[model samples]
Target: MRRSLAIGTALALAGALAFPSGAAPLFSGPTDDIGEDVELAPSSDYADLEDGELVVDLSAANPEAEGVNDDAVTGIADVFRVRYNGSQYAHVWLTHESEAVTFYAGGEPIESEATNVTLAPNESIAVGLRVDTTGETADGLLDEITVHARAADPEDVAAQGDALSFSGSTVQTRAPTETSRRFTVLGASAGETTTFDASRLALAGAAGDLTLDEVAVTSAGGSVSLAVDASGTEGARSRVAERGAEALGAVRVTVETGAVERATLRFSVPRGFFEARGVAPADLAVYREDGGELSRLDVERTGERDGRVRFAAETPGFSTFVVAADRARVRVADARLGQTTVAPGESASVTANVTNAGTAAGEQTVSVTVDGSVVAQRVVDVAAGDTANVSVPVERDDPGEYAVAVGGVDAGTLVVEAENETDAATAQSPENGSDEPVREPAGFGLRELLGLVALLALVAASLLLARRRPW
Candidate 1:
């Protein structure tokens, strides 16, 4: 330690001597910009520049400064060359409000061997300094710091000769590094972790003055994922605006593929966690699966074992499972709403809407199609007799009129024209309200009409006579 100090002192002195500011300064007084302005421009010229050493007088009540991390220290080293005793010389110095300080000038030497050169009145000097601190983990911590120096005749540095002045500035030291780690409370009732596959996750180190500390979890080992609401992780209560940072908080989590398949995560209530109005247990877990309840299971009084959840055994090409209590408790029939129509050059998707036609509420795996192709399919939950709609996009995939059917109901021809044409010809003509009047070949036309009248007259005369003798 002694050797290091000696080396530093020698360098500080050598640097001060080499510095060009070794000329007398035109102005040597307090500067509001660089340091505290104590004695500005002196009260008057009568205040001899020789006796005009700058002085910063503080009030009886010094303003409280921001607290800094005690473990760390920061300081500024200044090099000044000024004319004193009618000769040019250098001076390098370091100061810290409360932390340790290190100063360097030329090469390296001992403080005892270094000469203390004072400045002449109104002499200027070159100054360069650095400030640093340790242990300031949280950002925005502040501390008060001050620096002062003197300039006097080489023969009388103790007496007012050239000039003596005060210069100081406020310093705020912090270690935004470790403290930069943002945490978030990923709440969960279940003890299990939401595993984010290493291959799937693409988290790189923080950039631009930021760092990341891989979250440490008790549940699983190896590069574990960040569970925003991990069970027993972190939370926000009385505070507002900022939450979910410490629990391995990142500004955001981005998913690739434009497809979000593994996005689902599970979280359960920790002990003493508050329950919402609809929730039963003050503590519970949550899961969000497509087409299903927010979670697979919950701890609400209303969802008692009789919470028995049911699910469809198979969803055509896909299969699903249900809670043990619901396996046989419910009977589910999947009524498919398949593609019914496809216009020419047009293609339609096949999909189904599973209604819990059953007496109880349950979840099921269902299928849907987009443009005659399978695209959307998932396991969803529904209440008893309630209906859940599933509409998969149908891209004609091709251009041409096509025949299709929805729910096995045939949907005839479809026109895949950019615009549809009128189908007026397909319609039937209006009825004349007559079935050809049952014409007997028109009965030879007019003769038939006359013969019908003659026959009626003969029949009437015969009937009149027959009525008298008829049996």
Candidate 2:
């Protein structure tokens, strides 16, 4: 019994030394525990261990210092770490339930590939996060970053079973620092323009001097206070994104006492907004939501200066306004002729397919040319990422072969036949198998017999006169 006990003790001691300290038992069967030993811990200066979970606070974070105009901040490298204490190999990945924050791993955004890692016993990986405050007016808990561990490799087979273990961290944000301004317009009249010092209303990342001008209040003469805020709403941001546009920001203009009839407001937009969205200045537009309907306002680019572009927009009343890039590109895809042959003075048509491969609807002019001359033209409206058919009627007065083209594309030849006068007369004739009855030829009538008798009497009188003269 002593010899057997000594041998078992020696074997147990060897097995204990094989794995590192604080590692789980070796998994031997399919029913063994897989990922329950995984834990998450703060790995960087920005993160903290709270309530057994990692937390990152962005309340005092200033994005303006990073030269970013939009309200966004990126976390440091390895903000947090995911450690697996299991004995068997496991597949680990990170997921988040937030739209405002995005996590990163290994200096690259953890959208898909970077989020995944394979770990043996006592292995760990670090993660980071980026928080955007563009549409975040007030802030609280922003996101929950979750780390999932599974026994089976997701690449090899579908992750059908439940996760073995899951751990997460919370991200919190506070309201960003903002500067606001209020202007008081007393005894405002129609057709009167008022300017205010709107420089303070610009966002924290805005550079250079800012100005507001040509503010025309079309309401009745009264005193009103105009308040402007430099923040935007989440609804406006989502709507702009759905339209394939990037929202620069939103400005909220409110009337303290009563609403106005209409107003024309001009403001400065950051030049960086255009560069970041990769949109041209001409595509910039303003949108306003009224009565649950979002409508685009009449906007015009006035000028550019001091690293900012100026735009004037007409608004219905006091409300929030969203500035975005609305670009529309229209082109012709194909052209076809309705009929290749037509007679003179007959009408034919050319159809042109127009496509708008842009973010907004646009109008395109489809022109049909015959023999180097524009025979028909039409203006067609095509929706974004859609195609529309535009048909233009064409007529030919001369009989000949003409080269047909639509929207600058060669469509083919159009042949107009000469008018056949004989065929037209034959169509009207009864003898040519027409429906009308045939008429008989005209015979001797009373009028003709009377005319012949008068002629004979006159001839006899003339003969008697001549005979008397000769005798």
Candidate 3:
């Protein structure tokens, strides 16, 4: 009878140890206590625990979960709890096969080098998760993360039973919520302009400074829906500075449903943003940043009202739009005349070298002035950090020496000579013909005639004297 009672007691103890409530068998062993020793449960912060698995929903209501927008990172703390239910000290860590999500324990990241934390008997720790969504465009699910636990001391024989546990939970992510505005074009003809107020698309948080007041779309006929959202200016300040401009603000604009022939966006500028920077309304420009390239857009000043200035830009497609003033330093460096001397009614070429030292491309007027009067002018286009030689042809019909200036700088003097005078000078030059000195043709003069007549009279008197003496 005593043997029977001992056998029954042993069986009860074995069943109790091997099949503990709310625990799963981790491995098969000779000992009765070979079972899971770590428990995973939902924390007070999160209550979506189902069957010892945690479920998280990243939404706007959960402000602690950040990075709910495009080109952002998501971080959430205290996602769940990990408790060691073993009798001896054990190391607890998390393992996952997800590239998008990383797990953390007790505020420390769980990497290969630093994976585990020593948890005493019945101690618990909080777990967190981080997701990098820098280029993530779609919403999806994160892979399951397994909670692992093992004995801290390898040689502890008593810790052999219930030494390891492998359990995990599933994570799901939703699309980032945004405030948007939609406009519908009904039976619109081609080249027709439809306007809509998008003031409701102002985003909160870091990009709250930017607001889209209105949007005008030039359509290509048919009905279409256009949805617009304003994302913040996270890295726009430095980008504008790279282009030698000052960023007032920036926003990401997206178009949906159909293609637009043209889109005009009107937004408000910060009070005194231009005045403080000494930028004029005409100096304000809009640029679209796409694929790491910035292209300039045509912008117009929409006037100022209520202490605020407004501007409009015709955008080519939709992307990140920035409002800035390009500080283009365009000026004339020097000027040169093709020739210092020119014939009357002939044209002289005046070349002006224009240099752009700023970070933007611009156009400048190069004028050729003769004696303080503008004789010719031209518009020259110069890119940033480049130089362009603009040539202006000038003509002068009058013959004179005139001081010439180009692009507001003195170049040199221009001499205009008459055609007849040029010909006469060319004829007198020795290089034109003979090497001998020039002489006049032979001719009789008054002095030679008078001497001849006197000689004749003397000869006649002598002949008459001789004849009278002979008789």
Report lDDT (CA) for all predictions. 0.28, 0.57, 0.60
Off by over 4 Å in 3: 1-248, 254-265, 270-283, 292-305, 314-317, 326-329, 337-350, 353-471
Please write out the lDDT profile of model 3 over residues 155-269, one tens digit for every residue. 5534545644322221121112355444544334567777776753553222325456777878775333454545555565567667677666666765433358888999775
Number of the predicted model whose TM-score against the real structure is largest:
3
What is candidate 3's CA lDDT for residue 284?
75
Quick one: best lDDT, which candidate?
Answer: 3
TM-score of 3: 0.35
The lDDT, on a scale of 0 to 1, for candidate 1 is 0.28
The order by descending lDDT is: 3, 2, 1
How many clashes in each candidate?
67, 0, 0
Q: What's each prediction's TM-score?
A: 0.18, 0.33, 0.35
Comparing 2 with 3 on TM-score, the higher-scoring candidate is: 3
Model 2 C-alpha lDDT per residue in residues 1-471, reported as the tens digit of each score: 000000111111001101111112222223234434555544443444332223444334523223113455544565556566555556666554445566666566654433456555555567665665565531434223334456645553334333233322122111223444545443344444455556435532233333343355555543334556665455665665566654566666676532477788787756765666666766777777554456778778888877777788988786667766786778888887889899999988887788887677789777789888987778889888899888877878899998888888987788899868898768768777788754446876778899999999999999999989955
Please, what are the lDDT tens digits per residue for candidate 1 over residues 263-323? 2221112222222222223222221122321123332222212222211111111011111
Q: What global local distance difference test value does model 2 have? A: 0.57
